[model samples]
Target: MSETTTAESAERRVRRRQSRRELIVLAAVEVFREMGLEKATLEAVGERVGLSKASLYYYVRSKEELLGHVVVHVVRAQEEALARVLDAGGPEERLRAFCHSHVRIICTDPVGRVSAQVALSGIRDDVVRRPLHEYMSRLESILRDGVAAGVFRDMDLRIAQHSIIATLNAVPLWFSPEGRLSLDEVAAQVSGLLVDGMLAKR
Candidate 1:
């Protein structure tokens, strides 16, 4: 086959692989959320996805791999949110956009939130842990950049990142569409506090 055809074929194969992976991950998310990490059974996920337990093993090597996939998916979503912030206008705008995007993802995707909490402890593989830690590091980098730019107040980036993420991560626990505050409203409140705390003192 020609080089162009080969490249196209490769791209198609990648898409197919990604699609199958997504399906498995989605099913795993439901299973994990319902059962929690320690109790989640591969057989349950197989049933959810309409596959026999043995058949599901073809896609996922073990329950641990499924846990990894779910956590990795959440990490990827946060990374995408950070990329969106990079395209935003100024420090304030970027911070607000990041908060909004982050909160929306966490609250709306409960399964993702649960996966983020449970997967780290449950996975014994460095292959999974390293990437998750790196993705988390990106959040601190954003805060540090804002501080250096004089838009955000000088504070320990580690504490700030942890405090902010911990608060936002809890959104999945109590957030409700019918509740008093909308997602955007909660995000704005969080952004206000973070920005105000980080603003240069007059």
Candidate 2:
């Protein structure tokens, strides 16, 4: 009984620690996004989460580390969102879902906004760069599948993928949640244009 209780206590501690780390990461994302990474400070992030500078250190080692965590988190989210569409949708449907995913990532998610805003191509860490590479590959896989299925055009898949991503990434530059056009409206419009352009001729 004591062993079981001890194990449960340890598990709770781990869960709490993980929960706190995630909260701090979220706070860090907001700080970095608002202030831009080079200008963002640990003190600001800690204040957002109600933690002191010293206490924030317990959760994250540095601003760079927080950015890394945000990168990994953002990419993982993008992959998982696409994975769900890839699993059960047809080419057209999957492409539409991808549009929604793209919009949500850039416009709705704070971490994702930061990821898109930052010059991630400058990041050299393999751990950070690895997921981004996989993300690009997944995007190409979607394009390739669409082409093979006779849904997408026969043009260079790389160009198509890059164009789609570049257009979507530009959303946050001018997108406003408080604007007249809602997020869904933007996604639908983009998805229609991109997907319809790729449709196989009747």
Q: List where candidate 2 sits over 4 angstroms from the true fold.
A: 50-55, 75-88, 119-127, 177-180, 200-202
**TM-score of predicted model 2?**
0.76
Q: On residues 93-171, what C-alpha lDDT tens digit does candidate 1 reach at each position?
A: 7767777777777677865676556533545676556656675577677777788888788888888876776676666
Clashing pairs in 1: 153-198
Local error of candidate 2 at 113, Å?
A: 2.3
**What lDDT score is found at residue 49 in candidate 2?**
93
Per-residue C-alpha lDDT of model 2 across residues 35-91, encoded as one tens digit per residue: 877789999999999998888898888776777777678778877888876677777
lDDT of each prediction vs. the true structure?
Answer: 0.75, 0.79
Candidate 1: TM-score?
Answer: 0.80
Candidate 1 residue 58 C-alpha distance from true site, Å:
3.0
C-alpha RMSD for every candidate: 3.1, 3.3
